[model samples]
Target: MKKLLLIGFMLFQYMSFAQEHAWVYLTDKENVATSIANPISILTQNAIERKATHSIPIDERDVPVNENYISQLKVQTGITVMAKSKWFNAVYVIGLETDNISVLADLDFVASIDFADKSLNSESRVALSNNKFEIEESLIDFEYGSALNQVEMIGVDHLHVSDYTGEGIVIAVLDAGFPNVNTMDAFQRLRDNDDLLGGYDFVDRNDDVFEFTGNEHGTRVLSDMAGFIQDEFVGTAPDASYYLFRTEDSAGEMPVEESYWVEAAERADSLGVHIINSSLGYRVFENENYSYTPSDMDGNTAFITKGANIANEKGILVVNSAGNSGGNEWQIVGAPADASGVFSIGAVDFEGNYAPFSSQGNASQPTQKPDVVARGAAAAVVNSSNVIINNSGTSFSSPIMAGAIASLWQALPDATNEEIKQFVRMSASQFNTPDFFLGFGIPNFELALEIGLSLAEEEFVRFKVFPNPVSNILNIQIPTSAEPTNLKIYNVLGKLVLEKNIIQSETKLDLSLMASGVYMMSFESNKGSKTFKLIKS
Candidate 1:
């Protein structure tokens, strides 16, 4: 009796601190208009017929609601499912134990599920290997490709790649199976740069994710992050390090696969990985009954997603694919990718226009999904076999952005994840006014890094705005040695809140009637125009 009581007490403590998770809803098959445009719809209806849709919580607000759905959802699946989100055509759910999700699949109504475990498989992707360097050299078509040689070849206007590469940062790529990675010439760069950190094959539970054919997912992704650049195609972060972990199996999308992902994430975290780039997402699976509802978009649903969120909290920046099939029945984005802390990258063309195939979202429940966009259309990357192939999907876009993010982290070591995220969002081409299609818009890598560093430096300056979260009287205590050139403030709506030119040592402004929220302040010192985030209480 005493032992049982202690165990129960421990369970209670865990429940108290543990985060909530649920399966949530995406879209009902009944609601989907058609899928000739969306061949994926067949998968959804299959799930619905299998009671997979019923396995997901029913729409509480629907005309003929399944009154037993909510209670049964909690009792049967042991998770919470909230209301549906029209913006993303999904529902929100919250739960505790993210692992051992097989119990859900065993349920009569359930089809597929995700682990709710918060453990992450995150770690540094920087491991020096002869093979990694070789891939880098071979991809660039260089007799010998050094970091410097690759940099000189890329054709971007102003890429801050050197500062990042010189620092030697690592980025982990989590995706489907990678075939023939060992023999791939494209991987020589990863080997040469000493950036190919080891990874796990969660798909097959083996060390190799490339044992299968037709799955170049991992190979293409890793190449984008640390691929060697020649004339026409250049990766965003060619000099950075890389780690490859395969979480998806070639068979199809499923809950077991996500369990594998969670396990992988935990391993990554244990290795001290700095960043995780996951290009896999799930809405509908082979077991249609397990298709995700919008409510399941919360970070707490799948263990892998929970792990992804934890990765961010631990200072590891997490990036995920927004999902393809934009012009489909399940028009919203998919799970684990929808986790709040993770920065989901959407697909865009070279022109930075939103790709129609890019998944749409205001997130499943709330907050922004696909926090930013990157070039995904016709993304060029070297396959393991030394062949150059251009692929299209949010999957490719995610890794491209991940490379850029790794570069930024190398440049700004002291910066926090929030600082990095906000800086990237604010410096984007379409910032302030975000939408379902494009959250904050496309990030400018160089500009974002500059903004982040400037803010960190400025924070140390005498610019102390006392009573932050203030109702009025915003005071700026300027640094004695700094010269004030032009100061501007933009409201959350991107409206110019206030602007002034001052050469004085101190600055003060009054905001008696502005609605309270978050604001952006740009202070132009002779040095540079620095941007900072302000929250109004």
Candidate 2:
């Protein structure tokens, strides 16, 4: 009996030191009213301004997690507080999966507990997965050098020529590490301009993102956006400001990194970051118990995906890399990239052909997984040693696309996040017929700008059109005091299909004979000309 008792004691000790991870969700903040009333105390001035511009309300989620509850949890035996997320009203804790973590649920203030290890929990919970930082280095013009194809592919070169190079936009880069950005000559211009704002290392919980030399994935990723060498290499958004955060642990893959990522994202949102470019994708972890099934990639299942959607709700454009898992067993895009609000980017060759190595979208998803593609194969980027090199992956493609988006957003600063996404999607090569491989294919920023301008003009037009997808008849409502209006309809090929002149307040046009496709209608009068996009069904 004593031998059996000793064996039982040993097993208990083993379980105690397992060092399992879990999130302890709290019941309430207790200071929600006060924090919501004074958002400035919690959020930065820029963040408050962004919310006001987007009309997002300051709620309890904006309130910081109650420190008292955290302090209470810290005193518990065999438990260590790792990270706190106000957005989820929870704190990530590390302890024994059985006793220490489960005991937390007994506390009145503790609402529930979720274990990272799915089998450990009595209740069902999501198991997160993460991709290791990997890249395919391949061995890119004059002013743009080798970067010309990437820049011009998405029609951002025209915006650059017009001096709209992401001057006032702010982008946050969350990745593994930035080794030599502080000392690299390729980033000297960025430093001289003081556009490198700030950053944090959530893995080590420090601000020394460039202090480590273990992984340089982030260095290459940032080079696609902020790196500028006079007339040698230019990033997509050379003039944009940046905040670099190291959220991925280069030494290992763990679910804890997802919590770290959420912490970094919260900080980015507080700083009023306009865009988030995460070249890192998560789908599988070092521990098989935490691996995610393909069905879990439904945009809301993964923890990171949930946080990403919340980030979007806060009015930030989140861009992620569609994982490099193509032609493999797990071929679909990973979490956060699977998020509906995230602009997941895929890779394409210089010839506008889809890169087979780029991950594809799953048809079972609620929305398209990869919203667009950019040049990733043989893409030009600056390494940590200040050397311009070619790298291939959706990693490079995402930053390349993100930098261009910053420039596009700079041009239409008043446009909402949804509006910006709409314009870009509408300008893609395969907008009308997207496929699983390349989703919407590629976008043309030049055409996107034209679309935005045209829609802005339509807002002031005196005519109103209804039944946008009209089958047989189209109705146009003109002001009672309007002059004679001339209407012209054009097909997708820019060829005139129909034309008419109308003086009535309400005019109906017959279109039963028109082919079923997309068309544009233009109205001309003494005041000005207005254009409306129409779909003939």
Candidate 3:
């Protein structure tokens, strides 16, 4: 009996150390029905699971399986596998027979299945509590040519939609109470775009996804990123969709908050969400020893950090705030952003300068975080009165950037999340050189759109290439329908060195004599001048 208890304890410990949350991809390549039953229990030895897209959905509630119901499901749809405990209905069951996807899709009772992990891989950073402030003037809009911040907003009216927006993409934004979101006029565009989807509240552990309460900060963040665009402040992804999840309870910070985020992410994954955005992070608490040191930032110390990484592996894009209090003294950007796989966004002023309050990143930790910067400095967001208020924080910057990224994603649906991240990073204000303050700097969606690499369905200039990677000869393939065209080629440097004009069929350029380096070949046509990255080797 003692030996039995010891064995049970050992098994328990091992299970405890396993990944906090996980999901399996349901694919067409594998069958899910074969299971071996021992005298004690059903054992899964080897029947071929784990292939990409070879995943199955189970009830997250973990209610006792109705043998009758299971038999009926097998008869109705061909799903023969029973779910395992632990994850309940929250996780995708890996071995469901591949035949039920169509039938399951037809069932309105079934909500959604796992998409991909968009969680950030970074670990949580140590917290620095200083210089935190509230929104100013609630929410407001400046004149078309106002003395206010025009540097960042310059020419925003003509800014084209050409990047990923989570349009039709459902994201579960787990944070504190998003107070007064419905009352804000700035979020009206989200309503108009139908980007605002339904959500659940795990903070109160119920379903008041948009509760009206203290610290309207959370609501402002959501509005800046996913709120509909109006005459007030325009979010990055005005047309992208969202699922506002409330995981952070009001008033105080609790360790249980971490567990709540995990559950929320798991639910988000099950709901076929494309991304999960959490602006709330943890490091310190009223209980001082609960405070974390830099070493704990490996992503292993916190439950939420593990969930953050798991969400990424599943293919959902997770974006986190780098945190405030840069002016005082913080070690690096806080966790899950500090964890390895996530994108941490810092704040920069409208003048293209790093905000003094924005956090910094150390070269160490799970990863060098605060991967990029956005106009987090004194930016405009919608307030409770449906007014536009100017707010500032890495928080505000993150959502604004997220909105733009969502639009970019919308524009380029085919872009891998990592590719989208890289594209944004490469096209940032400071891609060539980065610093602790701004990282890769703010991204230029105009540039991203001009490249026309995104999956955007909108009409934009598309790059046409003929005989790509031409050795001695480069051809500018032209369509007869296109207007007259002008072409230019440049090395990595912005300096222009080659120019051409297309009169008829196609224009040819000689590159065999050119030095070896990545170059950009661009064409100015009727739609617009589009650019593409050229590889020489």
Candidate 4:
């Protein structure tokens, strides 16, 4: 009887301390003196460069949260700060039982106080396990070893042969944690060449992401893109640079992780990342009331989805994993995947059939989700121990598709993110008849490049140049149907080297004086103008 009484007392104590988390929304950035006029003061130089290239403006959203307001909130003894979102103009905090959170609503800076966790019941706060999906390892023999099937399935090798290996692209990977990426032999090339730019641990509020002892899910996801072992395994975008961020906490499931993801994405945008690959998704939360239903899967709903859309507007191609809930009762693609602008990926087998575990798109949503499918079942990956292995999940598929997209973007550096996405969709096998399981089917990089080139030709006047690597003379050929136009040749730096009038369909120019390098040729006809890359040998 005494033991039962003690148990009851402990339960009561537990309930007393389990107060709900809340977000204090500030009315405005009033107290903050930071100005939006000078984005360089807040954003990095790379970030500035991206904005300049993409013609994206430095707006009010780019400014940091008011430090004075946050500092004042920190002074409160009973509140523990969780995360701050500059995008939402809000700060998430956890209050103790003795704290009077209602008093915060009276503060001049405070807009409103809302509970982060809607459900306060202890039983509804149980953490969800991460072992819902099982990985199946398969052994395959090919010239490229473990990576051969996956890369070849998507035709990324063709881009590699054309020397489009995502050399200058920057990709930011947001995941649970990278356990052994720093020391793994498979990533030796990336480390030696400084391709691994840097990373941060948002959960711990530290910069030591490499040393963090967390799950290997991130390591596996990264392996599909950057891992390389000479003649053993070659990732899709082996030359692309990367920023690793730990946004998800593997030990627990909660809405706070969504805030962490948004924070990481904002950091990525500020770092001028060209692409973001997020394999994490949110659906069920520890607090049942915070969980999303199928109807909430609409693109505009969840916080992460909204954040992803904002990231897309900033010119970063966001690739996310369609949740792996197909076999379960709540079988539908989760949050950010439902977000319109994101390039969500699904899982497929080697035979081009949808993986049973791959989640389908939300039927109610108008947009066909899981933008495309990749070889996720028994997908090749290098483990944390530097050994090549096979794993299965949309997580692996998302990175595989992301790397290929990067390589494709490298081939068409002048194309906008939307153009690239459209070309990729057009190159899919089932583009015209997209289904829920595999939206546009598998994408072919070779075909995507061809489609992009064709679209460019249509947008601009079509012309041909010969003896591209010419040593003495270069030949220009305009279609007989085309009108005579002025032809100009510029160096890679956009400096005009020569200009001539093309009166006839066939024209020749002496180039013996030019040095050996790459150049751009532009033909300005009455109809339109076109520019093509030229090689001078």
Best-matching candidate per TM-score: 2
**How do all the candidates rank in terms of lDDT, highest first?**
2, 4, 1, 3
Candidate 2 local lDDT, 426-447, one digit each (tens)? 6789875788788888999998
Q: Write the per-residue lDDT of candidate 3 for residues 322-364, one digit (tens) a residue.
A: 8775766555676677766687888887777888877787766
Query: What is the clash tally of candidate 1?
Result: 63
- lDDT (CA) per prediction: 0.60, 0.84, 0.57, 0.80
The TM-score values for the models, in the order shown, are: 0.63, 0.84, 0.61, 0.80
Order of quality (TM-score) = 2, 4, 1, 3
lDDT of 3 at 43: 16
- State in Å the error of residue 436, model 1: 1.7
Candidate 2 worst ten-residue window by lDDT? 122-131
Worst 10 residues of 1 by lDDT: 127-136
RMSD of 1: 17.5
- lDDT against true structure, model 4: 0.80
The clash count of every prediction, one per candidate, is 63, 2, 70, 0
Identify the runs in model 4 with alpha carbons over 4 angstroms from their true place.
1-17, 30-34, 97-100, 119-144, 458-537
